[model samples]
Target chain A: MAEIVGAYFTSHVPSIGGAIHRGLKQDPYWKPFFDGFPPVHEWLAKVKPDVAVVFSNDHGLNFFLDKMPTFAVGAAPEYANADEGWGLPLYKTFKGHPELSWHIIEGLVEEEFDPVTCQSMLVDHAISIPFELAYPDAEQWPIKLVPIGINTVQHPLPSAKRCLALGRSVHKALASWKGDERIVVIGTGGLSHQLDGERAGFMNAEYDRFCLDNLVSDPDALTKDSIHEIVRLAGTQGVEVLNWIAARGALGPGAREIHRNYHLPISNTAAATVLYEPA
Target chain B: MPSELEPIPGTTLFDGEAARKGYALNALCFSFNEKVNRDAFLADEAAYLARFNLTPEQHEAIAKRDVLGMIAAGGNIYYLAKLAGIFGLNVQDVGSMQTGVSVDKFKAMLLAQGRGESYEVAHKEMLNG
Candidate 1:
């Protein structure tokens, strides 16, 4: 059976991609955020997992309002990243793990969680940025990918509770897999910042701190807040923390946090990176 | 009866109601992902916008480059971002535009929040103290 090695929770703010492209990591404004990743890189070097199952939200790149799926999982042989209208340079294509993706899709269905399965998906910065942050210099990415997109764009989003359940189902699927691949679950997006409305620049470090603490010690406690409450406490875009909640959920109970870094105002976001290993 | 969500101040929920209203506007912005579409839109803005079934208000909002106006006309920030990019406006630029602040001031506000200098955080500290 495949073993779930750990989980990573990160913020996928697109500007980070631009900064990397411009070689601005040491620039005073971006240094703190960039500084958070070296530890993650060292950890990845130490415990190399074979596959990464990423939980992220697409920012109008692949899916549109024409047909938005609450939850979509990728089963493609390869996933490509293209222009997201901001002129961020295209990233190298990612290899996929179709066999595991299919197993997880079936497991989600059996667990009463319906997910749209995609055999051809174009990943956006949400997946690309985090991968780049984790493996900054890889000529070719070391791990296979299984991208799971949760809808954070439109309202009527899956509750944090529901997202946690989805992650647990993923855990079950990975545990039951006939192969022995080591897997890491990644949840990308948010700590707290709103990019629209009169509250366009809203940032809540206090709420973000609360979430960071609770995400590890008491994930269920974090889920107690309804979607509306999360929007109020975090900001509108800050609600991307749903990706974090789902990633934490996949770690199962007794997961210990090994490392965490939080920095604010990373291009209209309170960026954070957390790594959790199963106890 | 379906319970209504209590509205958050200065925030639009982008629920079904807004999604339905903004479909054409969002669809138009979504097309900007391609360089050809971006160039086409730049060449003849009105004609390109006309290709979509945009509401009168949405069309006006785009014409004026009014960020808040676009939001009121049912634009989701995610999609509006693409349109903003076409005009070389980043989030901070539009943020300052909407908030009646300079870009530097808007950025300073964010830096203050990061440093725990915002009113909300200060108020919490006072209460706790």
Candidate 2:
């Protein structure tokens, strides 16, 4: 059976990509955000996950509103990063674990969750930035990937409760899969910062601290708030915390927080990173 | 029947209504993902925007570089971001434009929030007033 190694949750602010490209990791503006990744890197060196299952939201790169999926999974042999209209450089293509992806897809259907399965999915900054942060200097990514995209851009998005259930179902699928691959689940985006509207520069540190504490101690509590409430408390784009909540669900109960770092204003985002190991 | 969604002040939920209204405008912004399209749009902004057949409000909003006006015209921020990029405006620049603050002050507000200052309350009060 496949071994679920751990989970990582982080913000995937696009400017981090530019900062990385411009070699500004040590610059004062970016240092704190960049500093959060080293501990995760050290842990990754030790655990050496063979496959990564990423839960992230797309930002109009792959799916436009014309045909948006509530939840989409990638079963392609490879996934590429493309231009996101802003100035972030394109990232390296990621190898996919199609076999595992299919298994999970089948399992999700069996468990009564419908997800659009993509043979070819273009991952945006939400996946690439976190992956780059995790493996800063990998010439070729060491692990195969299974990219799962959740709808965050459009309204009427899947509820926080539904996202949690999806993650739990994925956990069941991973556990049942007949493989020995050590898998790491990653949830990327948000620690509270809104862009758009009169509330554009909103960042809620109090709410973010509440979420960070609850993500480890009581994820379900975080889900109790309605999406509108979440937006009010966390900011509009800050609702990307749904990704983190879902990823936490995959880790199951008693997933200990190995490390966490929270920093503010990483390109209009309250950036954060948390690593979790299952009990 | 689904219950009505309460409005969040200073926030526009990109729900179905906005999505429908913003489709043409957003599609135009989405086209910016390609370098050819971006260059074309940059070379002739009016012509490029017209190609999408955006609503008059959207067209005017883009012409005026009005972030708030664009939102009121149903421009989703995610897509509007691509449009902002063409103007070399990052989120802070957009925020500053929307809130009538300088970019530095906008950034400072964010830093203050991160450092545990409560601008959200003040901003909310301003919005309510």
Candidate 3:
């Protein structure tokens, strides 16, 4: 059976991808943000998960408002990274493990989750940014990917309780895989920062820290938080916290936070990163 | 009637109803993902919108460059950002437009809240009455 080697959570702000692409990592404004990833890099090197089941939300790449699937999983051989019309350079395609993806999808559907399955997709910065951060200097991504796309954009999104349940389903699915593979689960976006309305540029580091603490020590506390509460306090885009909640759920209760970093003001976001290992 | 669902103050919920209303306009905005399409739209705004067969309200909203109106007309913010990008408006600029404040003032309000301001209040005051 496949073993889940590690779980990680991080903010996938597009501008950080811009800094990495334009050779601006050393710039004073971005250095702190860039500095947080090296430990994560070290962790990835140590664990060396054969595949990463990434939990990220799309920012208008494939699904426009027309048919926003609350939970979608990519079951393709390769996933392309595309320009998001924001001038960021496209990264090389990441190889996908379709067999493993389908295993999880089947397990999810059996468990009553009903995740929308896609055979092709061009991922936006949410997927690309985290991929770049993990393997900064690779000619091609060194790790394979299975993307779990969620909807944190439009309203009436899946609830926190539902997201947590989905994560548990993902964990159960990974466990039932008969193949001999090691895997990691990753969630991206949020540690408090909003990107729209008069509340644009909202960053609550204290709330972010609270979230990080509970996410590690008492993540169940988070499931109690409602969509409105998160939106009002964390800013509307803060709904991406659901991605993190799902990752935490995938890691299961005994997973301990191994490394964490939180930083502020990265292009209208309060960024954070954490790694969880089975305790 | 008075029993209808109450709308959240200061926000537009892009739920199912709004998603249906804004589908065509958003699809038109989605087309701007390609640089060629963005350039085409910029070269002739009305012509580009006409291709989408947008409703008069959506066409008017696009013509006026009104973000809030577009949202009211069923425009998703993420898709609308493409249109906003064409006009060199960033998130803060959109927020300023939405709030009817200057960008500088809007930015200052964000700053006044403090970067580390943890939400101490309960959900009732923060989300609804």
DockQ of each: 0.71, 0.78, 0.34
Model 1: lDDT of residue A44: 89
Interface RMSD of 3: 2.9
DockQ winner, 1 or 2: 2
- Model 1 lDDT per residue over B17-120, tens place: 98999999999999999999999999998889889999999989988888888888889999999999998888999888787677877777777677868636
- Cα lDDT tens digits, model 3, A130-222, are 878888888888878999998998878888889989998998888888987888899999867765543455667667777888887677788
How much is the lDDT of residue A244 in candidate 1? 89
Range of the 10 consecutive residues with the lowest summed lDDT in candidate 2 chain A:
A245-254
lDDT of 2 by residue, A187-267 (tens): 999978899887888888888999999888788888899888999999999999999988888777678889999998788
Candidate 3 lDDT for residue A198: 37
Clashes in model 1: which pairs?
Answer: none
